[model samples]
Target: MQIGIIGAGGMAAYHAKGFTLAGAEVVGIADPNKPRSEAFAATHAIPATYRTLKEMKTQHPNLDAVSIVTPNKFHASLTIEALQMGLHVYCEKPPARNASEMQAMYDESKRAGKLLMFGFNNRMRPESRAIATYIEQGEVGRINSAQATWIRRAGIPGFGGWFTDKELAGGGPVIDLLHMIDLALYFMGYPEPNCVLASTFHDFMGNASFKGPWGIADGTGKMDVETACHAMVTFKSGQCLTIRNSWAEMNEREVVSTTFQGTKAGGKVERLFGIDGVDETSVDSAVLYTEEYGRQVNRTIITEKDETMGRIANAMNFVKCLMEGEKPANTPEEALILMRITDAIYKSSETGTCVML
Candidate 1:
């Protein structure tokens, strides 16, 4: 598989490495910033760099796929364009700025008959994979409810940059840190949501004290996104999901977790970060709760720690799916559903009423 990278950002490097590791040739890299593209190409030993995907395609016509690591606003447009050009797409998360855009991307992918996968990396983690196996085996049967949270203490990224700008990055932590929500939905079989009731807060929106250590460049743009979002979603199947996400909030440490209650048992997969985005200071755990022999039982699941938190692995899966005909880890259909839920959350927050799906 010949791959081209769409952005010259930090995530583009990760995809380049993952594609290379998966035995795929990275033909070129593209970014509007020539210097950044050139730097990224040089670092990855890519043979070419272009200012746009069209230029990359014109130069490397044999490119089989492209990885999009650009901003949230570009996800739908780029994915649709790549699919229209007869190339598969591996897009970074949030799917798109809104559900309608996500739907358009999905429709185009289907019309183009090309694979369209999104970056839901949390589902690729070792512990998550293990828990999924247990779920499949009925260890955790018929998940009735779940709680998904990605809360941070003073961890807002680029306070005034695209990340905090509602138009650029969609919403704040609710969208940026939606991995847990997607993971929980995946665990619960992606039931159709009935409605959502959400509340968003902007208490620490422009506070520099909440800036994270990600080193993302700060922008002088409007910081209109929320600092925190809490919501509850009810599914038509009577299952429930509660979400809590925040870029900055009162918390002891950064907590990223998903807990599910099932008819047969219950389980949790979590990462406790001493410092946000610093893998060396993170601890991971997966545990299953059950009853055996009329006694309460708790079993800890042990798996190798993924310092990258499945980012690289998720990219590698995209490569394998294209090259080896393996099923993709995620699909655009799932992404559209996630995006619809996200849209409802934002709408509900704005209207102060339950938004029905």
Candidate 2:
């Protein structure tokens, strides 16, 4: 497959490398930043580089697809455009600012008969998949509720300006650190969420002065987006999930994690306190501690895989679907549901009421 990247940022580089590892030729990369684009092209040994998607599409007419990793605000427009141009799209998550825009992109994908895959990387973690499978297999029996959190130790995106800006990021931890919702939904097989209520806070911006992997934010950083979001999501399955996402929290360690609360089997972070026995293998994502049969039992499953694993695995699945002429795992239509719930979270935060799906 001949792939072209829509953004030459760090994620685009990871996508390019992972694609290469997956035995696909990264034919080119397109970015508005000429210097960054040129540097990426040189580093990846990609023969083609362009300043715009229009030019890339014009140049590489044989390109099979485009992997978009631009900001959240640009995802919908770019995805629709790429789909209309007869290209399959594997776009980075937070697909749109709102559900309507996401639905439009999905509709266009249906019209174009192209695969549109959302990048929710948490789905690929080995432990997460294992436990989720176990839960489905009745290990968890009937699930009642779940609570997930992505907490950082005063770790606001002290990096690029795009993240803190509401216009560019669409929202804060609600959209950016949304893997918890996706993981919980995946474990629940994408249950129909009836209503969502959330409260968001921006109190930690004063402690946002720090170095970050994507670089640093300079000057007086005005965080116009939410730094924390605590939401309650209710489902028609009678399952309730509490979601906590925060980039700025005074905590001991960062949590890239989630949990599933069930009647038979409940799970939390697999191995929180250093690896030992089953506890160690579960790593950060999953932890199942069950006490039954007149005994205390603890079975840990470590999730060491990073977010990129899910993105790449989902992409590969999408590509296979394109080859087999079938629907993908993370389709644009399904992603619309996620986006709608996300919008409702923001609406609920603002209105101090539950936003129904």
Candidate 3:
């Protein structure tokens, strides 16, 4: 399969690598910055570069698919355009800046009859896959309550760049942390979210000690987004999930973990990797707690680093779906639901009241 990347940043490079790893051709790269695009093409050995998707389409008309790794603001427009061009899209998380745009992308994908998948790479992690399989196998029956978090001690990305710009990034860790929330909801079978109550904090925006590793220094750029967020999501099935995400905080350990409580058994998936690599580097693991012979038993499932490359798996799945007519792992419809919940969470935080979905 021949593929192209829509951005020249770190994520776009990552997707290019994944496609190469899957033995697919990365024909072109599209970025507004010519130097960045040229450098990426040189590094990735891609033969073509374009200033925009339109240029890429004109030059590489045989492209089979493209990865949309641009910022939140461009997600909807770029994704819809790619779909309309009859190209399958693998968009980054959050789907779009808002739910309305996400709906348009979804509608366009259906109209174009192409596969649209989100970069829910966390779900493809070996630990996450194991937990999902466990839940599907009824090992953890009917999850009722869950808490998912991705916390960083000082791990903001691009302090004053698009990552911290509300207009470009949409929001802070809440928007960026959609992967963790999506993982929780995915394992919970995607119950309908009834409402959301959320709060955002920007306490560390201008703090020198909290500046993260992704942006420029000197601190002269605008930082209008939150550094931390907390949310409570209620589902129609009477199940609830609490999300806690932060780009900066006063903590020693950093973690991306989720704990699920089910009627039959309880399980936890934990990864010590932080946003800025503060936490210990170890294998991601999932633990199951169950009563065996009237005694509590814990089973640990450890996933090695080589076990799964979620980004690669996602890319391969897209290729396979096109070639074999297989079903997608993450659908645009599911992504739309996630965007609605995310919009509600942000609105609730802004209005200081619960927002109904």
lDDT by residue (127-151, candidate 3, tens digit) is 8888888898998999999998988
Candidate with more favorable, higher lDDT: 1 or 2: 1
Q: How does candidate 1 fare on TM-score?
A: 0.98
lDDT of 1 by residue, 89-201 (tens): 99988789999999999999989999899889999999999999999998888999999999988888886788988888988998999999999999999999999999999
State the lDDT of candidate 2 residue by residue for 1-357, as single tens digits. 788999986567667765676667888889899888999899889998888888998988898899998878899899998998999898887888788888889899899987788777667656677786788688888778877777765566664477877888788888888887887777776778999999998876645442233354454434688888889999887888888888776565556667776778787643242211122333454568788788878786755555354556666665566555544666565687788889999999999999988
**Highest lDDT against the true fold, candidate:** 1
lDDT of 3 at 128: 83
List TM-score per model, in order: 0.98, 0.89, 0.94
Which pairs clash in model 2?
Answer: 270-286, 281-302, 282-301, 282-302, 282-303, 283-302
lDDT of 2 at 57: 87
> What clash count goes with each model?
0, 6, 0
Q: C-alpha displacement of 4 in model 1, angstroms?
A: 0.2
Q: List the global CA lDDT of all models.
A: 0.91, 0.75, 0.83
Question: Which 10 consecutive residues of model 3 have the lowest summed lDDT?
Answer: 274-283
